[model samples]
Target: MPGSLARFRACFERSPRTVVLFVVIVIALYVGIRDIAGDAIIETLDSHYPANEPLRDILRTARNYHRHPVEPPYKDKFWEVGQRSRNLSRWLAELNGPWGSQLRGFEKERLGTAIETTATSLFPFLSPPPPKQGSKTPLRDLQRSFTKDSRGIVIPAGGSDLQIRFAGHLIASLREVFGCSLPIQIAYAGDSDLPKERRDALLSFDKTNNTEFLDVWTVFDDATLRLRRKGWAIKAFAALASRFEHVIVLDADAVFLQSPEVLFQQRAYVENGAYLFHDRLLWQHSFEDRHEWWKDQIKEPSPAMNKSLVWTEDYAEECDSGVVVLDKSRTEIFVGLLHIAWQNTWAVRDEVSYKITYGDKETWWLGLELAGSKYEFEEHYGSIVGWEKEGSPDDKAVCSFVIAHTDEKDKLLWYNGSLLKNKLVDPNGYEVPLYWMMDGKWEKGGKKDMSCMVGETRRRLTGEEISILQHSIEAALRVDEVIASMKES
Candidate 1:
């Protein structure tokens, strides 16, 4: 030991610098190893391990007490859409040049807002403001109790018989999947269009006093008001503006095969005030699409397209209004959207200039485009559910297409068990089971080939539901016949 110590002392005395460098390097190497190996760990240790027994028990217990954190929803989407609106605004400003947006503003004067206002004037709901804040009225039910939070599910109806059928399917699915656990508000736009029997049948889904109807067709007058009145668009705005702290806006024709409770409790919904889906159906539009905000005041690029410095080809889009979650906390955004939608003006195109239109769908997006800078907008880029064409690509456009998108993790998009027919796809691009036609009939074993599938995998129809569906289809057929006769006359 004395000899080894003597040797080490002699080396250190000969080169103190070398010893210092060696010590520094050794310490650095240890730190490097620890940093590289530390936080990269992804999986939990095996629960069966003796050391992890306590951790395993703690985790299992936590599952029982997991309440969703109150957070803002879809910060990502709102940020992204807000950014896009900025870019679009800048691009428009650049195109307009010295005259700036002023030149482009001429189109608004020509046809857009005036046309939309005139068209919107026919409906009464949008004209009258919702009952005053903190006041009791027909629309506002302040004393109503709630189970989870005071969130309302709103389905806007277009008074189509197919809408009635789909509403039945949606309500039935909700009952089975979500246990019929929501205060659903049905905003009916056309009472005269809906038959007494069908309306009665729709009301029957609410045995638990969870369903309420807002008569949309009745044109109530507010004599005290001056300029113009509100209409159908107010249903969406009023739902958000009314007592419901949060509202899920849905199209009557859209169906939910699974429970959307997961969506409400999601980080995106809890965190943000508004949740919106991207406009997936942005294609060269036509009037038959029924989403005609573009015709109100649309911009067209000039004939000298390549040479012209200012290029305006901006057209309106059909923002998928089928599924929207509104948070009343986002007062600015909600009120802004209401104003933009109710503004009784649409975009149009003339020979010279192109202007932006304000269709219901267009107005929603426009409100976002304008308000993105002022408010937070959360846009989602996942599967969407709405009216879409299905079955053979060769067939005519399929109407009243039904689809749903649950969040990931429980993202079981299994359609019709394990059936996929002839490259059939659902509205959200997921492959769905397709039915075949044989001897002039859909071979799904129904009285008629009206539907493509018989049952859903997660929540299949019971005998009673099947009977209800059959009855609904029969009633729908009768309504169709009546419409056909009226048209022929």
Candidate 2:
């Protein structure tokens, strides 16, 4: 017995995994598991530990307390002693020992506390202590522990093959056209979202060989956050989950006029550690409920609340999340991400968030507000890009589908809605987009999915500006060719 105890102490010191097997074996045969399945246990540890093990499973199990469950064992009142009892039983079953019979006569309710304590001590990797409720420190610590010291572009791809095509354009623009060498991470929810073939196609976009793929499920345990299969929510989570300390989150269809690296050097981003752009300021009060909800949620108001269009102008939206930049090293930003994560969770979206805001756009700023974090939005409102209508009542009246945004200098920085002639109506005609409304008014009572411009002022692209647009269009066309090659071979 003394010899067994010594072996147990030694194995426990080496790894908690051994303690689990050692405890179970001791319970069953009153001896060491090292004597029965010693090599098997060692091999299991070798196969899984001190390497790139998929931590999602371990993390999910670790967080599986009675109060919070990855998957509830019973249909009713899941937050009870029964859950821990079930966890204890399931963990022991993996041992494939006679311990089940040993535990058969033990009172389940009485065993719950002991089982949890013993299991957590024996398998610390599989049973981490629950996070402190309503605290930013825990999330800050988690982010600090997980994040790496790097900067990169992160795009949440994978709803359909169409996203793959769009990502191809964006990646090509960054690498081939704008000449950005920053690393890129193509984040997807799971294997089903981005299959092996599509990932292989993305790998061909960057010749400098800095791009890689990240599974959102693998970034953090799904028990903590099971993202919706599709929607704007994925972008925020992708930005949060990325290994890069500083991340530029881009929509798959986003097109840039400049190398995005320049934004990192902006004074606002340098000061606040977060940067965002304004959505089209549609003058409508249709989102009173959302505003009220925000007021209730964010108790201690910050300067952002006073300056926001949501409160001041009664605008329905404030952020166009086509582009988002964040530095997770900031405790406020990391905590703000946690708030955004809760806001975008499957239940919250279906119940409140989506009904309140347009999509995931407003949640970004609102979440930051809720966490008392600071972020900077561009000084200019959203602008329009594309050609003027052939026959318009006003000479400068423009009817274009592209929603453009500007930099701090009020110059045309980038735009969403793609590079097609008319992304909504006709996609085949790739034209050199001209005419923009820097300070134009959004004509009210417009039809759905249309940007009707009413301002007499329009800014035509300079020769240099036209050249930049042309370069992005060519890069997109080149990506189309690559996709064609992929389909063929």
Candidate 3:
């Protein structure tokens, strides 16, 4: 090796220019090889973490452009080489070794500026100039109203007649307990088409409550239009429904344990859009089958369309779709996207279609992203309050207030029993228990507690109440055990 080194040194000295040119070529090849290797590494990473496809693709494309200065095919002019460089710099800084430490400081300064600029383009409204510090009198004076009127109809679509009757009974119980005058309208749209008797039932329910009956026929051209068609119609309806200053759309199986007005109050902050209680689990399931489609969909910088934009949680996390609140202005945008998504859904079936266009929740998130609308997320509204496999102590905590119930009859009974036994509602038309808001457990010099309590006279338990509560608790425990076994399987 020593002799070879001496011979090579002597040859180089004799032809320095030739040696220098050869050296340049070698350096170029090394850089080219490194670049190729980096691309391969990125591709491997993407395969492992497919959920981060958009971010991964963006990084890869940016790296490619940097290694070989070529214009990308996409029209997102905002995603340029400079942005890619910033991202690469950030990624490198998050790694180990001297290169990472050296790049960290540079990334810190550049990342802030890059992120701000990128966010401005993606979310222009978020850049609105802050108002001068002053009393929030204008905001406070915006006469926001959240009244619980017992005036709406409840309609069941896919469940059995017993289920329909049970739903009706639950609605009736709520109306009686909460002094809500809203009449629930019920209907079915299973294998059989909308039958005349079902139509008559809906009409009768509507007439009795002086409210309008809404059927699948009224909402969609055809109820059995496949998944894509159904999704589109639902989106369009949600958007149109938003025109009402306060409109709610819920799945039929959901039971209302307490008034929904509480959700409305929180939704008022969303000036341009509506609030949604999203279950992270549902979001994951919605995307699990459509990983490829999602990858393609997120090639550009889309804060709204990106699932990573939201926080991730465990698989056990569940969200309830029993309730949704929408402001009128935002609904129009959702409706427009619904039409687009419906078209996409019809074009294909299976994983891609389902991931890219099916679920209303995804469309809702994407629509919000595209429209640049603000939304408030309510965790309580999406909670699985009563159906834990292990009868968690946390379940007891849920009994404090009015919850949108999603459990079966047995679980409902358990919840009722807990609420009744705990006396979460005090006498005197105020101080109702709420999981989000404790009934009367407010500190003297803190935020004022805002819950209405039922009078003491209604606190006395009747035989029917006692029996229902007991049965519900037992059934709930059994259901939990069954669920636990299923999870094990």
- lDDT of each candidate versus the true structure: 0.39, 0.67, 0.36
Q: Higher TM-score: candidate 1 or 2?
A: 2
Model 1, runs deviating above 4 Å: 1-149, 193-196, 217-243, 281-318, 343-359, 372-489
Better of 1 and 3 by TM-score: 1
For each of the candidates, give the backbone clash count.
33, 0, 23
Better of 2 and 3 by TM-score: 2
What TM-score do all the candidates reach, one by one? Answer: 0.43, 0.70, 0.41
lDDT of 3 at 242: 24
Best by lDDT: 2
Sort by lDDT, best first: what order?
2, 1, 3
Candidate 2: lDDT of 39? 32
lDDT of 2 by residue, 184-280 (tens): 9999877888888889888888888899998776644555345644457778778877888888999988878778998898777899888988888
Number of colliding residue pairs in model 1: 33
